[model samples]
Target: MPGTIAFVGDSLTAAGRWDEWLPEFTVSNHAAGGATTADVLAEVDVVLANRPDAYVLLIGTNDLAWRKSVEHVVRNVESILATVHKHEPSTRMLVQSVLPREPEFAASIRDINRHLWQYSSTVRAQFLDLWPVLADENGALSPVHSEDGLHLTAAGYELWLDALRPAIERLFAVPTTTTPIDVLSDAISVSGLR
Candidate 1:
């Protein structure tokens, strides 16, 4: 099998079907109904125990719901990054941009995404922009992608996959073969990273 990857997030990441969408990687998601960075940190030990080769963080929607400032959320994210550094130092990172919420919260969502993009550069973390995938022309969640006007429906997750696949493929292709080569390792080694 390919290296294990863990996804830490809230409801959207836990939407009961990401595995069906992307089966190429071994995905272990630790997501709850309303998880925040704080909640994720609390359970990271369990996730780290898996010796994940990478972590895909899709949190912050709950923080946004709580009306937390972008800086505060980034601080939480930074703390998670530090945790990853200590435990999974060799792990690559992929951070999905916080999706836009309701129209009233659009500014805050934009603010969070701006900081996410800026800070993603600072940390060499790959940033996946959900804004394009989730937002309508007016910058709220596109009705097509969301059922609750916030969380994803099947179509929303499809949008997520469309945006996410390129990055995930790129991650899998990279030579993170940091172990005794197994059969799965050899398969990737021969194919080369696209």
Candidate 2:
């Protein structure tokens, strides 16, 4: 059976047409323009209400833009994950790295992504690093990906879809021992993360 996936985040996620890119699964973009990590925390109820089988999140850029420290954003994200697990222990999760932006905040973005990547592993969520594919040689958001240096262009969205496809396939792949959903729920229970 095809699984349902929700994309939750800011404008970067809001701007994508996920259904068109991944027709094999049910996709919903629950993102809003100019939203931050705090905004996502507020949307937790709405996001989980849908009862999606999986979720892909890419937030924190707007938080950084609003001058919130990277650590603050990370903490908010960890809380968000905990809440998600509490509500739906079996859902698959993929936390994408915060995208690279203009030069001035490049280092901060990288630091946030680094922390998020590590946190994802600890929480049993997969981390998808966008920097390698989206950043230019100088570590800035590649102009080819974003026209305004923040939001993605058509090509950028395509790249994101391409990068995410394999993971989605692996996530929805058939299981050997038990149903994948049951396995995930059991794993979460054993980890005491819920």
> Which numbered prediction scores highest in lDDT against the true structure?
2
TM-score of each: 0.84, 0.87
lDDT of 2 by residue, 1-194 (tens): 58899999999888788898788789899999999899999988898999888878999999988999988999998888777766676677788898888888888889988888888866557888889988997777787888989989999888888888887776656332223455777999999998
lDDT of 2 at 53: 85
Q: How good is model 1 by TM-score?
A: 0.84
Candidate 2, residue 33: lDDT: 97
Clashing pairs in 2: none
Count of steric clashes across candidates, in order: 0, 0
TM-score winner = 2
Question: What shift in Å separates residue 167 of candidate 2 from its native position after superposition?
Answer: 1.9
Pairs with steric clashes in candidate 1: none
